[model samples]
Target: MPSTEAPTTHDLQATARRVRRDIIRMTAAAQSGHPAGSLSCTDLLVAVYFGGILRHDPANPFWPERDRFVFSKGHATPAYYAVLAEAGYFPTDELLTFRTLGSRLQGHTVMGNPPGVEMSAGALGMGLSFSLGLALAARMDRAPHRVYCMLSDGDCNEGQTWEAAMASAHHRVDNLTAIVDYNHIQNDGFSDYTRYSGDGDRDRVGGWVLDSGYTVKGAHPGAGRGGPQGAGRLMVRAKGLDSSLRSE
Candidate 1:
């Protein structure tokens, strides 16, 4: 079971460090994987799993009452696997076999292969919709568990993402929350061609997100506040890596 009490800041930091190390080692062993994305989202995962933001029992991953965490940024499985392993969902040693021909830890997440994974995702835009479905199912079942979807800025550019966002709002899916890893980089290069904001550290990107009618709340995962509350809201955080391409 997850810790009933919140983890101390030092504990969270140490866990984040170990998770990041695992991400690097796993990707290095695989010889091909998206380490950057994994690294970027490490803190978020750490906060959720170790900081007690997510209610899950690694011993019984399929527990019907556990909150669902959907990694919409599918390629970031290195972090996903590492976090689950750290949380005791599976043996940490299995992480080295990631991307191997027969390993359950594939390049992207596949449900049922690993114990904690709630969704099988590879395409960019589909995770939000899938999470929405889960949220809706829980609602229909009158289940109390919440659904969380972690996305990348690239996913926001997808039309389906917007569609799902609007639908989530329209349906009043308050049990679902979307978090975007606003790293500003994507598979095709930077997510947007726009220039950096006046602050220089941030970019003036994802204008379409506001146009999509979703309020984006900035969050710092290390704070352990458990992300934004309520549904139909997108949480944007600058905790991701600036580059998407993994340097060999």
Candidate 2:
């Protein structure tokens, strides 16, 4: 049985900081990676891994009853591996093998390589759909697990994201929570300025969620307040994105 006593928030924060440090170091070691995105997501990853929200056993990655987390933005492998190591999924030493040939820790996330990772990600906009399917299956089996998906704002432009948004809402997979790391920067430059220009607009990303019938909640106010620099932050939490599986 899982321990009923959760780790203290202070410990969680420490773990997240260590993870952030590791992200920089590992990415530097690998000589290539999305350090910005990884740093942005460290906090959320720590919260989920240490906050008692996920059902997982590092010793048993394929445990059927475990909760699922999909790193849709797979470039953030450094952040993910850090969390997995802290959670005991694999030896912390294995992190040094990242991005090397024959190492399980590829630039992107892959299942069956290391324990704790639920899916192979990094293609963008696909993790949510995959998570939606997992949530649906859990519901059918009368299980009480949840699916959490992490996304990138830059990737939100993908049409498939909106399509999956509609499908998740249509099926009412309330047990699934999708978090957007609204970093505002992409590989080329600032995402908002590049895509929509810097107007005094509400989160166009959040607007999409609301339009799709999900209850929207912001983690903070202002630009870049909810992304990687907001390290270890909770930007937003939505409910009823899946109305078919109502929570209340």
Candidate 3:
């Protein structure tokens, strides 16, 4: 194992800023990309890559024992690619090739086109299933690796998301972790999937619905609704795995 340890939250926060700046520059160059979604998840990505929470190595992208990160919320490639580049998965300059023809970086993520992208994300909700497969494989192989998939609130609109959730829960896939990025706003303007506590459904973000969109309490909400009201109540629940956060 490498002797490197995780960076402090402060340093990770700094790296996140650079990642955000990269998102701004990359999206501007692409001229057609999701900036809001990408910007919203910058710190979360940094927390994983540089926070030392995840075990991975950009130098050895295919290392079997390395942790896996599936960018399920692939539209956020600006942030994802920026993280990968900063993580040393590829050269930072390659980021400039974001969406041009023949460029490895597509508008959405493609597995083989880039060293860090684990799955080819095009549709809204396939990441959970794909990640479940990796987690199951790791279990069967007894490999000490974890697979983390990023999901989005928009993904909940798809039935496949539920199917994958059921499957993950059934198999007890502990190695898999899903993070949802519920910005309360999707391409369609606003996401109406809200969690109802006792009083009723909140029409706005609150509780666990953090400003950054990550669930506060626990990751159960396949729906990714938090009350901004606080992460404790009014949440979506995706059972099993390391819990569900916002979409990738």
Each model's lDDT comes to 0.71, 0.67, 0.67
Clashes of 1: 0
User: Candidate 1, residues 1-248: lDDT per residue as tens digits?
Assistant: 55587666667767777988998898888789998878777766776677666788999989889988888888999989998998898999999999998899999889876988888888888899999999999989999888878888777778898788778767777677677776677776766632223222211222112111111111233223233344344455543232321210
> What lDDT score goes with residue 247 in model 1?
18
**Could you tell me the TM-score of candidate 2?**
0.78
Q: Best-fitting candidate, measured by lDDT?
A: 1
TM-score for each of the candidates: 0.81, 0.78, 0.78
Ranking by lDDT: 1, 3, 2
lDDT of 3: 0.67
Which has the better lDDT: candidate 1, or candidate 3?
Answer: 1
Clashes of each: 0, 7, 27
In TM-score terms, candidate 3 sits at 0.78
Candidate 2 global CA lDDT score = 0.67
Q: Give the per-residue lDDT of model 2 (tens digit) for 1-248.
A: 44445776567667777998888889889999889888776766776677666667777778787778888888889999988987888888888789999999999988867877778887877887787788789879998776777778755767777777777666655566666666676788865521332232333533222212212111123212122221121123222222321232
What is the Å distance of residue 94 in model 2 from its true position?
A: 0.9
